[model samples]
Target: MNKKQKKVLTRIIIASVLMIILVLLPLEDYPLVRFILFMVPYFTVGYDILLKAFKGIKNKQVFDENFLMAIATVGAIALGEYTEGVAVMLFYQIGELFQSYAVGKSRRNISQLMDIRPDFANVMVDGVLEQVDPDDVEIGSEIVVQPGEKIPIDGVVIDGNATLDTAALTGESVPRTAKIGDEVISGCINMSGVLTIRTTKEFGESTVSKILDLVENASSKKSKPENFISKFARIYTPVVCYSALALAVIPPVVRLIMGIDPLWTQWVYRALTFLVISCPCALVISIPLTFFAGIGGASRAGVLVKGSNYLDALSRSKIVVMDKTGTLTKGVFEVTKVQAVDISEEELLEMTAMAEAFSNHPISRSLKEAYGKPIDTSLVSDVEEISGHGVKANVSGKVVQVGNEKLMNSIGVQVEDIVEPGTVIHVAIDGKYHGYILISDMLKEHSKEAIIGLKRAGISKTVMLTGDSKKVADLVAADLGLDEVCAELLPGDKVSKVEELLATKTDKEQLIFVGDGINDAPVLSRADIGVAMGALGSDAAIEAADVVLMDDDPSSIVKAIGISKKCMRIVYENIYFAIGIKVACLILGAVGIANMWIAIFADVGVMVLAVLNAIRALSVKKYK
Candidate 1:
């Protein structure tokens, strides 16, 4: 507990004990003495509230709930209902204590998830190691990370190798091996090796810093349910206060005018009970706590939720649109077949690798990998890359063409049709068509399982949107059993498609779009909820998305959706529980059917239970 909570607890305990002692004494025979003792407990337990009420009135915020509570309880004491006034103050304090505890617990959870930021870095300058601020570490500078230390910046390894624990960043327990020439990301711990790295990014642009920024600013985005409570509290508090006042004054005044004994004390006691029961603690505390816990739970699973509003939208998503490359597919090209006519397969691969060595396309990389070693670029001459087609160059004094069917047809080389479910690259040597190489992109390991999980999570439709060809998109969608496929679309086209989908959604349904490419930024922003896959290495994806799946796994989407649904469930549960109890007690208090003890249950006991229910949103099993 914080110091303020401790002080409040101490004051409440001391005041309650004093009130009990005063009540047990022979103070009924001395009405003045009994009244003074009651005033002692009332002032001790409720002085801060009264002070806040007065300050709020002076600041022109007189309609606040604190003002209402203070006036009602103090009015009860004035009418000789001393025990009700003291008990109301004491119970309200207890409710405040529970709220403080819930807030503290939520802070602890968020802090644990956001502890990935490193404080210092070891910068090497003038052949010597020097300690410096993380922000001071520039790009291209060499830094040393010791065992149990966080990687200060994103960089490439220059010297040593180590096993890195990326669980805090990816929620995956598997240790990754890093060696010379390999890339290392920030926010991962170097488990057991002394590693020297050449920084490729500044500290401000590092992964850890970006993740911290996302988690820290998440709460600024309000959810729908939280907004509802804020609006409800604004109108609810003052109305109840005035009604309680009318209940206290109108009945006694009517009885006195009618020549009957005016029972002012009993009616005033009911007004105090009414005030205690109407406190907005339960609704105000539980709604935001639910969202906080949901965001914390998602961060622990490597899913960064930018706001609670997105979580609520994700829970109601009916149509899920996804990108094929980098999202559903493995996004890695592989050499599936080498069809050779005149030359052998090895000769064809060797000649093509030499010609395609200068290209950075995925197909060129796969051809180079087929040769299994770096080629001598000096042997290649007259190199030319055809835009949207392929490359042509002179390898070892012979002209070679490495491209698709369009390039082959443009160069007047006729090749036989090959029926294959993959990309076809035509190759030619010395003015004669040699053969065509067929390559394909593989699907991710968890793509099918994620589709199944989405169906189980109540998603009605699954669609694939990609810039890839119609054939490839259809094959991938069919293999994954998706309901729809939209292919060969540019960034603007994707946005238009999402707009069309949005038009079909009802007020109760939501649409979510998932993508990982820089080109998908438009669509990500256009959708109701944008989920970025493989966001760990992509800066544009992180910036454009509402939620980021750090692990690049499709299965995390299911987990994210499931967690969102569970959080919404908890929020509704708390809302109904709080409102039901408050309404029942309010009616009973106005009719004189309930006392101060029952009013305490409506205020403090219901608040504690609702807060505890909100914390259940942090449980991992809800997703499992």
Candidate 2:
């Protein structure tokens, strides 16, 4: 508990004990003594609330919760309901204490998840290492990360190798091995060995900074449910207060004018009870707290939801359109089959690796990786890379061509057909077609489980959109049990397809598009809810997305959607329970069927129960 809450609890305990002692004494026989003893507990328990009420009145905020509570309790005391009044004030304070505790707990959870920022870095200056703030380290500086230290910036490794613990960023337990020439992201801990990384991005533009920004500002965007409650409270509080006033005076005035018993005190007491029962405290507090807890829980799992608005939209999503490469698939390619026409497999592999050594394309890297040995660049002469086609080189005094069918056909080399669903690189030696290397991208480990999880989470449709060949897209879709597949689409074509799907959405349905490419930016921005697979995605995708999956796992998407639906359900339950109980008790209180004790239950007791329900949003197992 905070200092203020601790002090309040102390005062409440002391006051309650003093009141109990005085009540057991013979003070009832002395009316003045009894009143003074009663006033002791009343002042002790309710002084803060009275002070807040006065402040609200002075500040022109007279219709606030504190004012309503103070008026109702004081009026109850005037009607000789001392015990009920004191009990009501004390319980209301306790409810406020509970709310403060829940807020503190949620803040702690979010802070722990966002504590991935590194303080300093070891920069190499004139061949000597110097410690400096991460922000002070410039781009292109060589930073040395020791064992057990977090990588301070996004960069490529120039030397050394190590195992990286990426759970802080990705929520994945698997430790990735980083070697020379591989990129290492910020906020990942180096588990073993040392690494010398050449920084390629500034500290402000690093992954950790971007993630922190997204999380810290998540609640600023309002969701529909939260907005509705806010608007309801603003109008409901004033209307109920004025109605309670009318209930107190109108009937008694009419009775007096008609020569009947006024029953002024009875009607006034009922009005006080009505005010206590009608306070909108429960609805105002619980609904937003539920959303805050939901957002915080998602952050702990490395999923950054931009706001509650997107959270609400994600909860209603029925059709989920996903990208294939880098999202459903691992995006890692390998040479699976090699077919030679005129030359052998060994000759084709050697020539392809030599020609691709100068290029940095993933396909080129896969071909070079297939060789699995050091290449003697002396054998590669006159190397030229042709954009959108392939590469040309001179190897061992023979002209070598390594490219696609277009590259071979352009050079008058007859290409043979291959029946694989991947990019085929044609190889020709001295203007003669030798062979082709068939490389395929592998599927992610959890792709199938993610699809199943989505179905279990009540998603009605699953689709895959990709720029890959029709055969490749269909194979992946079938393996994952997807309902629809659209392949070989350019970036603009993907946006048009998404628009058409959006047009078919009903009032109860939402369209969610997931992607991880710069080419997928337009579709990601055009969907009802855009989820970016952040791990391997381009910066453009992240900026245009509503939610970012830090781990790049498709299963996290299902978890996110499930959590959102559970949160929305909890929000509605709190709203209905709070408003329903309060309205029912308000009617009973005005008719004198219920007392001030019951009004206390309607105001504070209901608030505590609703808060407990809101905390359930933080528990993922409850939804699962």
Candidate 3:
């Protein structure tokens, strides 16, 4: 327990001992002396409550839980129920202690998940190892990460090989093998062997920093239910306070007017009990806690939710729209087939590779990788990239074009329509159609399972949006059993399509767009909930996305949705259980049928039960 909680516990123990002694003493004849003795222990365990009530009244912020607690216990003492008054405060303190401990436990769990922040990065400076802050390490600087040390910065492995413990980053227990030329993200522990890496991004832009930032600011964006509770409490507390006052005074006045005895003390005592039962502690505390636990649970499963608002929206998502490359498919392109019209296959490859050599697009890299030789950049000059079309470059003093069918037609070349189920790159040289290469990307092993999982989870429509050919998109969509497919779209067209889908969905439902490329950032931001494939996702897309899947597994998306639904269920349960019980007991308390013990159960007991239910949001194994 924290020091404050320990101190509160100590006070509770001391007060309980004193209260027991007071109850055993025969001080009925010396009422004044007995009152003074009881007051000593009463103030000891509950001074903070009274102090807070005073402060709230002074600040014109009355009618909070503290105020209600103070008024209820003080009124009990005034009615000569000193033992009940102290017991009420003691049990309330115990409940608060439980709440503090529970919240601290959940925060610690989240902190451990995000404990990947590096203390320092080891950089070789002037032939010596100098440990410096990761933020100070410049891009391209050689940093050495020894065995059992965290990879302090995102970079490329330049020397040595090791099995990386990526559980902290990806929540996968299996260790990943990293060798020279392989890209490694920050926050992963190097399990074995010393490794040298060339830093590629600054610390602020690294994966670890982005995740930490996401978690730290998550609470600022409250969910709809949380917002509703906040506003409800602001109005509910004041209205209840006035109702309690009316119960105390108006009932006695009505009895006097009806010629019956005005039992003022009895009605006042009932009003105090009514106030205790009406305290909104359960709804105020558990709703936000449920969402917090859900976020922590998702982080442990390698899914990071940026805010509770997204968590709430994800629970209501009925339509899931996803990008084709890197999201569902492995996004690794390979040259499956090459057709030559008027030249040999080697000549066609040479011209295509030379035109795409300077580009970093996955398809370009695949063509260059197929060529398997260094490009003579001197022969490839004046490279121009046409948006959504292809690349135009002067290859070997000949104007060569490498792109889609649109690019071939834009250059006034008569290109034959090739019906294929892969990303086709049409090549034209000196205004004549040369040939085409079919580069295909393999789908992720879990992509089909992920789609089925979403459908089983009650997603009404599964859509695939892509820039690939209609045949390739239709093939992937059919194989995955998607409800809709929109192909041959550029980045702008993607945002427009997302907007159209967004308009089609009901207000009660949300649309989720998942992507991984730099161009996907626009659509990611436009959708209701943007899910990014963080492992291979571009920084732009990650920054724009509301949720990030660290393992790049499409199946985790369904897991995330499940977590969201579970959290919302817990939240609503707490709200209903707390309010329903409070309202029932409030009615009984006003009618004088309930006493202090029953009031305590309605207030503190209900809060403790609600809190325990909120903790269930941390359980992800059930959803898995």
Candidate 4:
């Protein structure tokens, strides 16, 4: 507990002891003395509530729980029920303490992420390393990270190597190996070796800052149930207060009109009990608490939800639309096979690698990597690149063409047909058809399990949308057991496809789109719930998505859905449970079958139980 909460707890204990001592004393013989003794504990535990109630009325905001509480307890005292009034205040304070502690515990879970904030960055200055505020670090400045320090900005490693503990950013315990020329983001702890990084992004625009911004501002966007309870409380409080007044006055007047003995105290007592039962504390406190705990739990699992509204939407998601590359596949091209016509396989790869050596495209890099030898650029000349086709250049006085079928057709080379589920790079030399090399993007680990987990988590359909070919898309879909696949689509077509999918689902069933590329940004924004792979995701995709999976693992998407499902379940359960108990108790209290003690349980006891259930949303380690 915080110091404030500890103090409140101490007050509760003191008030309870005083109540017990006064109960033991024989003060019933002296009514004034008995009232004075009960007032001691009452004021001790309830001073703040009374003060807040007075301030609320002064500010013309009288329709609140504090106002309701103040009126009920003070009315009980006026009716000579001092002990019951004091007991109600005592138990109410206990419920408030429980709520404060639960909120603190949830806040602590999220605050642990604040450790990701870098204290200082080590920058090279005049042949010496100097420590400065991370925010002051400029782009392009070379920074040095020690074995135990956090990387202060997003940058490429210029020298040295290290194992990075990415748990703070991704919640994965496996350390990542960072070597020369590898891009490393901020907030990763360098576990071994000293390294120098050339900053690619300023500190304010780094990954750490964006994540912190997302986590801190999440509560500003409340869910539908929370907003409903807020509105319900606003209208319910004043209406109940006037109804209690009618219960106290109208029935007594009716008795007098019928020439019957009017039991004013009996009617007034029932009215006070009604006011106590109508506090609305359980609904107002537990609904938002459940969502907050759920968001915290998702963060613990490496998923970052933008707000509770998105979390709510994810619970009802029936269809999941995913981009093929970078979302399921690794997006890294690898040379899988080579078929050379009349020439050695090594010779064809070397010529193609040399011709495309100047290009930094993934296919070009894969060709160079397959060749496994340095290219002699001096041997190549007259390089030409054809848009949407291929590249042509002269190598060793022979014209070499490397591209797709469109490039082969333009060069008048009739290449033999190949039925492969990977990208085929056609080759030609001096207008004759040579062989082709096959390249494919490998699927990520847990990609198949991610699809299965989604089905188990209650997702109805899983679809793949990609710019890849029909064969390659079908291969990935079959491998991962996806329900549908849309292949050979441009970015705009992907958005239109998502719109069509959106039209297929019911209004109650949300459609979620997951992607990790700049091309996927439009579709991500167009979906009902956008999920982005944050570790390797483009900034545009992350900004557009409603939720971010920090580990870039497809399994985290399933975990995100699971967390949302659990949270929404808790929210509804609390809503139904609290309202059900409260409405039942309110009717019983109005009929004089319940006393102030029963009213106290109906209000404080229900809040305590609801809060305990809400905190259950924060435990997701054992979940999928």
Candidate 5:
């Protein structure tokens, strides 16, 4: 506990001991002395509440929970119910102490998840390791990360290999292997060996910075139910205060008019009980706490939810639309087959890899990898990119085109159709039909199980959207058992398809669009919920997506949905339970059937129960 909570606990202990001693004393004959003794305990634990109530009244905000509590206890004191008044405030402080401890626990959990923020960078300066602030390090500077140290900036490894503990970012305990020429992001712990890295991004634009920014701004965007409760509290507090006033005065005046005793003290006591029972502490505190805990739990599981509203929408999601490349499949392409008719296989592969080397597309990288040797850039010239077809480059003084069948047809070079399930890249030399190299993208390890998990988790429809060919898309769809497949689409076509799907779904059901987060911005924003998969260091995906999975795992989506559904269930449970108890106690208090003890339970007891239930959102390990 912090110092403040400790002080409150001390006061609660002192006040409770005083109340217990006063109750045991026989001071019935000394009314003045008994009242003075009870005032000590009443003011001790409730002074802060009274001061806050006075400040609220001074600031023209008089109808809050503090004001309700102060008026109820002070009125009971005025009616000579000293023991009950002191007991009410003492119990309320105990509840407040519990709430403070619960909130402290939650903040500590979230802080541990965000502990990946790096403090310093080890820069190689003048042949010596100089520790400097991470923000001062510039791009391309060689920084050394020792074992048990965090990689301060996003960069490429240039010297050593190490096992990286990415659990802080990905929530998965498996260590990732980082070797020479591999890109490593910030916030990962180098567990095994010392490594030298060349910085690729500045500190502000790194993955750690973006993730911290997302989490810090999350609470500013409240959920719909949370907003409703805020508005309800504003109106509910004043209405209850007025009702308590009427309950105190109307019944006594009617009794006098009916020619009987007014029973003013009895009615006034009932009104004080009514005021205590009507305080909206439970609804005001537990609902937001539930959502805060949900966000923290999801972060601990490697899923970043931008706001509570996204969590709400994810719970109602029914249709799941996913991009094929980089979302379901491993976005890496590789050469599966190589066929050459005129030239030797080596010559054809060399010519095609040279022609495609200038492009940074995934297919180009795969072909260059298959070549296994660096290209002499001077041998390739006049590179042209045919929009949807492929590339045409002058390779070794010969016009070579490496693309799909449409590129060969546009060049008037006809080739036999090959029935291959993977992508086929046809090759042509000097406008003559040569051969094709069949390339294919493999599925991620969890892609198939992710589909089944979504179905098991209650998702209705699963679809795949891709720019791949019909044959390739159909093969992947069949392998994964997707309900629908839309292939050979441009970026704009994907948005149009999402819009069409949105039109087909019911308004109550939400639609989710999962993308690679690099090139799917337009579609991501157009869907009901946009999830970016494997978006550890991609800034575009982090900015465009509503939900981001730190690792390249499809099953994280299912877990995310599970967390959201569980959180919303807890939210409704607290809302209904608090309000139901409060209303029932309020009716009974007004009718004089309930007393100050019941009012304390209705206010503080219900709050404690609600808070305990809200804290359940923190531990989500059993979600799987």
Candidate 6:
């Protein structure tokens, strides 16, 4: 417990002891002394609430639970039910103490998330290490990280090698090896050798800063259920207060009109009980607590949800649309097959590598890597790249055309059909068909499990959308067991395809799109819930996405869905449970069948139970 909770707990204990002492005293002979002793316990247990009630009344906000509790207990005191009034206040304070502790427990997760905030950054100054604020570190500056120190900014390793513990950033316990030229994001702990890194991004624009900002602002975006409870409390409180007033007055007037002696105290007592039952504390506190715990739990699992609204929407998602590259696959291309017609395989590869040596495209890099030798620029001349087709160049005094079938056809070369399930690059020398090189991307180790997990989580369909050829897309879709495939789409076409899918889905069902490329940003924003592979995803895509999987593992998507489902379940359960019990007790209190002790159960007891259930949202690992 926090200091305030401990203090409140102390007050509760003291008030209970005083009440017990008064109950034991001979109070019949000393009625004035008995009243004084009762007031002592009452004021001791509830002085803060009474003061708050008076302050709320002075500020023209007179309908809160504080006011309700103060008036109910004060009315009981005025009716000579001193012990019952003190007990109500004492138990109410106990409930408030429980609420404070529960909220603190939930907020501690967010505080642990904030632990990633760097206290200081080590920058190199004239061969000397200097400690500086992370925010003051400029881009392109060299920062030195020692063993067991957090990387203070996103940067590339320029000097040393080390293993990094990325648990703070990605929740992955496995330590990752980092070497020269590898990019390391901020918030990772350098676990071994010392490293010097050249900062690629300013501290404010770094990954750690963005994630902290995302988590801090999440509570502002409340879910539909939370908003409804907020509105319900606003309208329900005043209406119930007026209704209780009428309950106290109208029934007593009716008794008088019937020529019977009006039992004013009996009717008034029921009104006070009604006021206590109608506090709306359970619904107001538990719904938002459920979502907050879910977000915290997801963060611990390396899924960063931007807000509760997205978390709620994810629970209702039916279809998942995914980008093929980087999301499900390793996204790194490698030469898997080589086909040569007139010349040997080495000859075709060397020619293609010579033609692509001047280009920096991923496919070009794969071809160059396959050759595994540096290109002699003197042997290559007149290099020209045809947009959307291929590259044309003269290598060793021989003209070579290396590209797709479209380039071979345009150059008057009859390209042979290759029924390969990979990206095929056609090679032609001196306008004659040479062959094709098949470069394929490897799938992620967990990609198949991710699809199965999604299906198990109740996702109705899984679809793959990619700019890759139909043959490659279909092969990947079949391998991953996807329900549908959309291939050869540009960035804009992907958006249109998502729109078509959205139109086909039920109105209440959501379509979630996951991607990890700059081109995927548009489609990410277009989907109902956008999940990004943050570790390797582009900054734009990460910014556009609603949720981020920090380790770039596709399986975390299913885990995120599981967390959302659990959270929403808790939210709905609390809503139904609190409202069901409250409505039943309100009716009983209005008819004088329930008294102050029952009122405490209906209000404070219900809130404590709902809060305990809401805390269940933090235990989301089993759901995965």
lDDT of each: 0.88, 0.86, 0.90, 0.90, 0.93, 0.89
lDDT of 4 by residue, 252-358 (tens): 99999999988999999999999999999999999999998988888777788999999999999999999988889888999999999989999999889988988
Q: Least lDDT summed over 10 consecutive residues: which range in candidate 6?
A: 533-542
Give me the displacement of residue 248 in model 3, in angstroms: 1.0
TM-score of each: 0.91, 0.90, 0.87, 0.93, 0.90, 0.92
Model 2 Cα lDDT, one tens digit per residue, 1-624: 889989988878877887678767876668777767788888898898999999988998888788888999898878777777777788888888888898788788767766789988998778888889999888998999999898988999999999999876776679999999999889899999999999999999898888888877888999998999989988888898899899999999999999999999999999998998888888898988899898887876767789999889999999999999888987889898998887778878988898888888989899999988899998888998888789889988998888888898899977766656677888888998888888988788888998999899888989899989898788788888999999999888889999989888897799999888456778888999999885432467568899888876778888889889888999999988998899899889988998888898999899989999998887765223
Per-residue lDDT tens digits for candidate 3, residues 1-624, read 889889999999999899999999999999999889999889998999999999999999998999999998999899988888888888888889888999999999888877899999999988999999999999999999999899998999999999999887777789899999999989999999999999999999898888888888889999989999999999999999999999999989999999999998899899999988898988999999999999998888888888999999999999999999888998888899999899999999999999998899888989999998888888988999999999999987899999987887787887777766687899888988878999989889889999999998889999999998788899889989999999999889999998999899889999999888466878888899998874532577567889888887888889889999999999999999999999999999988999989999999999999999999998787343
Candidate 4: residue 482 lDDT (0-100): 99
Those runs of model 1 whose alpha carbons end farther than 4 Å from true positions after fitting are: 125-127, 337-360, 373-402, 406-420, 426-436, 622-624
Instruction: Give the lDDT of residue 395 in candidate 4.
Output: 95
Task: Output the TM-score of candidate 2.
Answer: 0.90
**Model 2: CA > 4 A from native:** 122-132, 142-144, 158-160, 257-259, 340-348, 351-361, 376-417, 426-436, 536-538, 621-624
Pairs of colliding residues, candidate 6: none
1 or 4, which is superior by TM-score? Answer: 4
Task: Kindly report which residue stretches of model 5 are placed more than 4 angstroms away from their true locations once superposed.
Answer: 336-418, 425-437, 622-624
Candidate 6 lDDT, 1-624, residue by residue in tens: 878888999999999999999888879788777788899989998999999999999999988899989988999888888888998899899888898899899899667854687888998788889999999999999999999899989999999999998876777788899999999988888889999999999998888888788888888888899899999998999898999899999999999999988899999999999988898989998999899988888887788889999999999999999999988998899999998997999989999999888899999999999999988878888999999899999999999999988999998888667766788899989988888999999889999999999999999999999999898899899999999999999889999999999999998999999998466888889999998875532478558989888887889899899999999999999999999998999999998899988999999999999999999888767343
Candidate 1 residue lDDT tens string, 1-624: 889999999989988998788777887788988887788888888999999999998998877657866876787778777887788788888778878888897888778866788888998778888889999888998999999999989999999999999988888889889999998989999998899999999999988888988988999999989999999998898888888889889999999999998898888888877888898888988899999999998898888999999999999999999988889987889998998988999999999999998888878999999889779989999999999889999999999999888888887888776656579888999879988788988889999999988999999999998888888778788889999999999878888988998999898899999998466888898888889998886788889999999987898899999989999999999999999999999999899999878888998899999999998887765243
Worst 10 residues of 2 by lDDT: 533-542
Tell me which of candidates 5 and 6 scores higher on lDDT. 5
Model 2: per-residue Cα lDDT at residue 266? 92
- TM-score-best of 1 and 2: 1
lDDT of 3: 0.90
**Cα displacement (Å) at residue 371, model 5:** 7.6
Top-lDDT structure, candidate number: 5
